[model samples]
Target: MERRKFLKDVLKAGVGVTAGLTVGSALSFASQGKIELPLPYVKLDPKKVADRAYDGYYEHECAYGVFNAVIGELQRKVGGPYLGIPTLMFWYGGGGAAGWGTLCGTLNAAGAIFNLTCKQKDFKAMIDTLYEWYQTTPLPTYIPCKGNWCKQPFPKGVSHSPLCHVSVQRWCKNASVYFGRPILYNSKERSERCARLSATVAAKVVEMLNDYHFGNFKPHKVKGSQKTKMDCRLCHEVTMKELS
Candidate 1:
């Protein structure tokens, strides 16, 4: 059978047998049989990587105040997959409340990209690239309290919430394992390295989002009347102080 036909047959059979086999197990069986699997667009290569990352950067912090200014420019000029709920949720959950800080955002962003360029042959490369990217980017400034717009308020009547703290710690631990390296805390060298790494990844993601040929989805601008640009400086600075 042709490669595509063989893959289709395997997928159909996998679906039929799902009752008896876990998804991962079915996939593993398919893999051993030489059946191909789909992959996300951004995981395809360096170009796609740049595109997806860019989309994440543009949508950072749910900054709806400046959505019109940024979204149109990104769509028209950057010309990639418009940010969607899955992408936003990943960032908000992992980057915002999940407590991974910037590291989660970066990894989640990479995962989104991975979904795009995924192919059976590319799985190893995709996993490796994700780890490689994380090893270079490291962690960013973290705030334990909820004073900033990006974070949720501490649970009602509690001075401190162990759940929130635990969540962030878990994210960091997972990230370190994914990258196979110790997580880097904010420092002069590490900070600069993370900033540069983020920019590089963001640029790659944007390119992939555009190149994948996915239909355009309307950008969901954040709801607010504020007329200011949101930046890392505002969020990190204030939140760090609150945590301290």
Candidate 2:
């Protein structure tokens, strides 16, 4: 498969999988009896790595936020897959996908990391957990050490879906903040939330990957993920109920 297609497929299903060339040694994994090469990565502490990513979110925004966050962590001790990546390129994922509001950019960033550092099989396990966590959990979980928003109350809300529009909308509803506003998409509050979210995601991914390396990782048993009534579920058979 082509790189972009692979990235999209993995990410939409839970990943990018960031698409780019790497300077580090590529690791190959067996998939369906075929040997495939993937992006390079080194082992890391999950929470510490995530904390690093959270800090990066404040430096950049969603796409770049998590991207920079993970990259920063990687570059500190190891350097290869991220040598030539463009920093500002992926910010387009903001407000869904590139201003289109499709998938959350933070999710996009997570996908990129998996594609670069892990196997395809790992995507579902780690990415699925990440997506589920995002959907069911309260966001902006990370707070800046220095900022007024740090003390401000970050409302809790669950986005039934992962679309940026719906995620932001759900948060707005729960917080009761976006009902009437001059601008809804851009705000310090929202940015702060996404940053925290980005950090949370990166941290989760790091832990998942570490578990995979250590053979302790577990994939979720739930099926049909991050979809609008999953296509797979469409064909699911149902048992008959009692009838009058």
Candidate 3:
């Protein structure tokens, strides 16, 4: 009788755990900026991660460049919940979130995946650095590396905004691709550029994750031309409201 009762209790505990995870995942999807609680994460190789981003971009033509790149590694290294997960849902992240042109799809994937493993305290700084990097750096640096699918040396441009339009416009300006001039910004080069950028972002996220794992993650202040006037107390106020 005691053995049967113990088995029943174990089954109940398993159900409870599954229910908790379901609730957490639902909340995660609903709350965009909120952090998801940390999950067990393996320290992925930064170089390999970047390569996957590059390859995946070319493979799927969207943030799948970032998603498929890392998902395979996650599946191979840490394969429990990630097993058999389909990329179909993530397809909408392309062309600025299903062609609406909002946030860069690469960054979107990076943020979504990053939050899954990063602790709450570390999420903001990592994302801030990534956005700053995207805005200020002349990108697609990985394209020049050997074995990259895109071989042309396109003009480099700095996008002051992380929005897709600004990034594409800057590329267009640099390449001199005007309104009836072959739309170089929308050509194959543009896809390659985004793929490379996705790789860069993926590698950096891996670096950050490793640092966090080792208790060495540090955030530097990012100061660019544009600054938003956000109140520091708002985060605490929001948390209080949520708790209430």
Quick one: best lDDT, which candidate?
Answer: 3
Once fitted onto the true fold, the runs of candidate 3 whose alpha carbons sit more than 4 angstroms away are 1-36, 144-151, 177-183, 220-244
Ordered from best to worst TM-score, the candidate numbers read 3, 2, 1
Q: Residues 31-78, candidate 3, lDDT per residue (tens digit)?
A: 675423665577688899898777777766557777776666776666
Per candidate, the number of residue pairs that clash is 25, 10, 2
Residue by residue across 94-144, what tens digits does model 1's lDDT show?
A: 333344443334444454444444444443455344444333333332222
Runs of candidate 1 with Cα error greater than 4 angstroms are 1-86, 93-97, 100-103, 136-196, 204-244
Question: What is the lDDT, from 0 to 100, of the residue 217 in candidate 2?
Answer: 70
What are the runs in model 2 whose C-alpha is more than 4 Å off? 1-36, 45-55, 177-184, 225-244
Better of 1 and 3 by lDDT: 3
lDDT of the candidates, in the order given: 0.37, 0.63, 0.68
Model 1: per-residue Cα lDDT at residue 101: 43
Q: How far off is residue 55 in model 1, in Å?
A: 8.8
Candidate 2, 112-208: lDDT as tens digits: 7766677776665666777777777766665556567667666656776667777877676666554344324466656666767777777767777
The full ranking of all candidates by lDDT, starting with the best, is 3, 2, 1
Consecutive 10-residue window with the lowest summed lDDT within model 3: 227-236
lDDT of 2: 0.63
